[model samples]
Target: MLPHDDNPLFATFARAQIRVERGEGVWLHTSDGRRFLDFTGGIAVNSLGHAHPHLVAAITAQASKLWHVSNLFEIPGQERLAERLTEASFADKAFFTNSGAEALECAIKTARRYHYVNGQPERYRILTFEGAFHGRTLATIAAGGQKKYLEGFGPKVEGFDQVAFGDHEALAAAVTDETAAILVEPIQGEGGIRAVPEVCLKGLRDLCDEKGILLIYDEVQTGIGRTGTFFAYEHSGAEPDILASAKGIGGGFPMGVCLATAEAAKGMTPGTHGTTFGGNPLAMAVGNAVLDVVLGEGFLAEVRRTALLFKQSLASLADRYPEMIEAVRGEGLLIGIKPRVPNGAFIEALRGHEMLAAPAGDNVIRFLPPLNVTPEEVREAMRRIEAAAAELSGRPAEGAAEGAAA
Candidate 1:
C-alpha cells in the first residue's frame, strides 16, 4: 500500500475483490482462475461476447495501422461507420462519441439545436422521465431524473424537467412552450427493467408532433440488437427525432453514437460540438465489426428466437418459484427477474452455481446474456437461475437486495 493508504482520488468501487483476467464467449476467468458464466455480459456491453473473432480481428487490424487520430481529417472508418449507422436506423445523420454519457450529451445538444435552428431559442428545456437512466455526466444525471445518482451533486443543471415515466398526462403537462424535447429510454434498463409501453412511445411521438418538440430515446442499453430488433423502437414502430446509442454499439469497445435527422442536426455547426476520440479509426473499426455481426444474415432473427426461449424459461422459473421469483420483464435479451426475495440475494446465490447476473434498480436481476447466446446457453442460464432461487430461498441470514451493476 502507498504511504497514504486512503487516497481520496480513488473511487469507492475499489471494494470489489475479484479481478477479471480473461473472457471468451460467455465465460469469464478471474485472477484466481475461477470460471463464471457471464450473464451480465459486462452489463450488456459485450453483445457479441468476449473476444469474439470478428471484434478481435477488427481491433487488431485497426491497432496495427492507426489507433488515434484527431477528427480534423477525413477518417475512412468514421465515414463507413456513419453510413452504416444511418442506413440501419431512422437517422439521417450520426455523431460519434466515446461513451453513453457523451452520446446523451450530444443528443440533448442536437435536440435543443433543432429548435434553435428553427427560430425557437427559448425551446431549450428538455423534459425527461422519472426512473430513466441516461448517463453519469452532470447534464445526463440531471436529465435522468433519478434521485439516487444525484446525491451530493449540488445544484442540478437547469433546462431539465421530469414527470412520471409512463404517465402520459403528466408528460403532456410537463411539455410547455420552452420545452425543447422529451427524452426517454424505450426500455428503462437501470430503472428496474421497466419498459415503456408501446402505446407510451407512440403517445410521446404524437405529443412531440403536436407541440413541435423533438423526441430522444436513450437506447444505450437497449440498442444494438439487445432488444429483438436492431433498435427497440422498431417493435413499437415509433421513431425518435434524436437518439443516443452506446454500450453494445462496439460490442465491447468504447464507442457511442448520437443520431438525428438532417433537420435536427442543423445547429451542430463545425465548432458547436466535438469529441477528440469519438470517431477514431480504432473505435470505428470495432463499431463496424459489431454492426456487421448484428446486421448479418438472420443474426437479429436468431436474437428474437433466443429471446423467446429466455423469456419462456424465465417465465417457467417464475412459475416454479412463486414465493421467490415473481414476474419477468424487459425485451429481447435484456431480461429481468423481479424476485420475491431481494434480487441481490439471487445474484449472490448464482455465484455459487457458477453463473453471474446483473442487478437493476428496484428488486430485479437482469439476465443480460450476450445477444449471440444459444438456446442451450439460455436453458443453462435458466437452470442456474432456478438453482439460485432455491438456494436464495434457504438463505434467511443475508438481508438487503442486490446493487445495480447496470
Candidate 2:
C-alpha cells in the first residue's frame, strides 16, 4: 500500500511502491524490513555498490575540504581528476557535467562547433541512429528521434538526421555534404542492450574519416567498466572524436564527463560553454575515487571475470526456461534478457521474489549487478531468477536441480 497524503511529486516516474530505507553492498532494505537483491545498481549508477567505504570516505574528505567553487576559478581536485581521466583514455581534454544528458549536450555542441570553427559552418547536421538513447534535453531528444520522448515537445531541435540502428548502407546513404558528425552508442543499454558489432563500429569510424566528419560515442551506460572494459569503444577498436560518459563514473555520485580529442575541442574557448556545478570539488573527489578503483591494477580484469560468470548463469537460465525467456544478450555486466512474458510482469515477478531488475526497450529485462558482486551473490541471483521463472510459468520448482547447471 502506498502512503495516502498530499503528494507533491511529479507524475513523470511510474515508481515502484516501496520505500528503500538503506542500501549496503548488493542489497536494499525497504522501510517494511524487506531485503531485496538489488541487481539494478540504481539503474547502472552504483558502479562500486552501495555505501562503499572508499566513496563515502572520498565524499567526507572532500566535503570537509571544499564543496564547490565556480569554474571561473582554479579547482585543484577538478584538475587532478581530469588528468587522471585523460591519462587512462584517448581524450586529450575533458569537460565535466552534472549528468549524462549534459555531457551529451556538450558533445553535440562540440561537434557543431568543430565544423563551424573549421570554416564549414554549413556542416552542422548530426547523423544519429534509431534505437539510440542519448538524453532528455531538447537537442538530445531530437537526436534519439523517438516520438514517445518528443511528443508534446513542439518544434523539435534542428540539425539531426536519423538512420536505422545497424544499417550501414542506410547510414552511408543518409549522410550528405552538410553532415557534421555521426553519433552512436557502442552498446544500446536502454534499447534492449543491443550491442553494435565491432565491425559496424569500425565501419562508422571509416565513414566518418572519409567524410571528414567527427565520430561521437555515447558511452554513458557502457563505460566505467560496466561492459567488462573501461569503455565499450575499446572492444571495437573504434575510438570517437568525442565521448560522453556518466552513470558509473561517479560510483553513484551525480557526475558526467565529455571527453574529446585536441582537434575536436578547439572551438570550446573559455566562454563558449560552461556549467556551474560541473566539476565541483565534491563530485571530483568521488570521480577520482571511482577511477582509482576502476583503473587500478587488475581491477577491470576481475570485473570481466565476474561478468563472464554471471552471464553464463543467465544464458543457462534462458536455456532452461524457454517459455519465459526468448533470448539473452549484451556484453559483460550489462546483460539483457528478452522475455516471452510481458517485461513489466517479469520485473514485478522478480520484485516479488526479493530481487530488483530494470526494464528496457524491446521487452527486455536488464541485470546490472555491482562490478564487485561476489560469486555467491551471483549464484543467489540466479536462484531467485529461476524461482521467478517457475512462478511465471506456473510450474513446480526444479530450481535445486537446475541451479547446479547454471
Each prediction's number of clashing residue pairs? 1, 0
Itemize residue pairs with steric clashes in candidate 2: none
lDDT digits (tens) for residues 300-328 of candidate 1:
99999999988987787677677887799
lDDT of 1 at 365: 90
Runs of candidate 1 exceeding 4 Å displacement: 1-9, 395-406
Using TM-score as the measure, the top candidate is: 2
Q: Model 1 clash pairs?
A: 344-402
Deviating ranges (above 4 Å) for candidate 2: 1-5, 399-406
Q: For candidate 2, what is the TM-score?
A: 0.97
lDDT of each: 0.87, 0.91
**Model 2 lDDT-worst window of ten:** 397-406
